[model samples]
Target: MFRKWESPEAVFHLLKACSKGMPCDITGIDDYRMIDEKRGIQWPLPDGHPIEPLSERRLFEDGQFYTPDQRARFVFEAPRPLPEPTTSAYPLTLLTGRGTSSQWHTQTRTGKSYVLRKLHPNVPYVEVSPKDAAELGIRANEWVIVRSQRGQVKARVFVSHVVQPGQVFMPMHDAATNQLTFAAFDPYSRQPSYKACAVRIEPAPVGRSNHSALPALNLFIASLGE
Candidate 1:
């Protein structure tokens, strides 16, 4: 389907048309010059040289690839399971991806805009397998606390058949979710395992901690009253 756009101009025109829903001049050199001026100011300046053209397209032009031979190299990597697991307490393995709507990542900047915030709030949510839901005694749209090795946060529960028996999914837009996630990094990419992680979802606790600190606070308040 995309073979018709072998030319960069055609691809640019297609993107413009898709975004604006109107046909635009794809053959015009002015568009390229405008892009160069506004963004690069060095490329295609009527001098035939793009600001950062692919000056070096091919290497080792001896009609062959590889080092001293045309043999292909193979790369092997061992597979490792995700860090988190579905266990007795964390019976559902939660995976997080992107949200479906218009908000950006974590809704950090987009969340500030009133319009975008109304469309999507900074709320963490968990996807649950039907089997897990039955076992956990929870339902969709209900609040639950997801706890990990790092911390805990409240999120609404969502059920889907797409989720497997031991796996759950979430969108990584809410800070609350981040608080509950580990900050471990991948060996190759140095990226966090945002998708698959161990999580336990239960009914959120209702009361505050009854630690003796509360009595200290109360005593202080009482002394002030005197």
Candidate 2:
């Protein structure tokens, strides 16, 4: 189906088929030479557009809009209820995000590099606040099962003050995180959310600890990644 999609000719035709006029019209960029000479063509460059530096073609130069009233439209949406609110059964809020610079989402490609693998923790782990850890009898580097209404994942625990007492964080890079994430989508954008969910953590059984296998977190340098 995508036979020649990589060719410039295919891209030009595809852009024309879905062009939205001024906002993203780029049917003018029909040739590879045009692209090479232009360095890069800013969007809305319809066919026969005058030659100018790509950045020089500014939008709304007259401070106006195409609307009948010549004004921009703003979208407002009422806040929706939390997808998975915390309850007595699941008291802690779970936050999932990037954990290291060496890894990308799901670590699909970055995980294969030997040097990158050595730069971050090899096993999946969840961050728990010291207060919650003490209350739940969770020690650092201990295996704990993070359970949500959707599912659960076994993660090594890293108790620190980074997270609030009632909240925990897991790296989105781990493939297993999706197993416990609640599937919820926004009404307007129809985008799925992965930021928050309600879950509870409990230490795994006694034998779950591997004294010599699992490496303890470098809590002193808590700046894992952005």
Candidate 3:
């Protein structure tokens, strides 16, 4: 079944003639040919479109919407509390976001290039405010264990004023980063609340003279497999 529709042409044909019907206005092979001719084409470019020689275009120029009233509607709701709140054990809020513009999500594809890797930090590290680091006795570039209710992961501390005293920032590129995030989600969108979680940081235990952070990380991952 998989081999039957492997090629791009076959997939395109199937999309054009699906029983459920195509969501967009992709009619036939000519539409694809038009896409190749023009670098890219916007969606809803049905066959015999009014705008000839389709180039770049925008939708709803006249402020019209796909509604019975032809006007957009806005909805508002009261804010809800975070699923995991900070406690005495886990006092700091862990905020996760993109590390660098050069690195994509998870680093599955963008991590391949040596040049790209050089542009960003090679290893996972958490951003800690100077005030917070000073209180915790954590120095810059020192190994630290970030712990949440879900799990814990070792990361290097980067002392910066960018984060607030009660908040720490970690990039989502690291695999272990998500291990500390709670499975709570928004009720409406159903998107997991990856931004905020309760966490605490402590200095990592000293290792042998020959052991390094990389080897420690490998051991941590191996332990998870068990």
TM for candidate 2 is 0.72
Scored by lDDT, model 3 comes in at 0.76
**Candidate 3 lDDT by residue in tens digits, 120-214:** 54567788999999999988777889999889998877777778999999999887899999998777669999889999999888766214455
Number of clashes in model 3? 0
lDDT against the true structure, per candidate, is 0.62, 0.78, 0.76
Clash pairs for candidate 2: none
Best by TM-score: 3
CA lDDT for candidate 2: 0.78
**Candidate with better TM-score, 1 vs 3:** 3
Which one is best on lDDT? Answer: 2
Ranking of all predicted structures according to TM-score, beginning with the best and ending with the worst: 3, 2, 1
lDDT of 2 by residue, 45-102 (tens): 7777776653476777767887889897777988876799999999999999987777
- How does candidate 3 fare on TM-score? 0.76
Tens-place lDDT per residue, model 1, 23-71, is 2212233455576665634221232334345344233344544444765
TM-score of each: 0.58, 0.72, 0.76
Task: Kindly report which residue pairs in candidate 3 clash with one another.
Answer: none
Clashes of each: 4, 0, 0
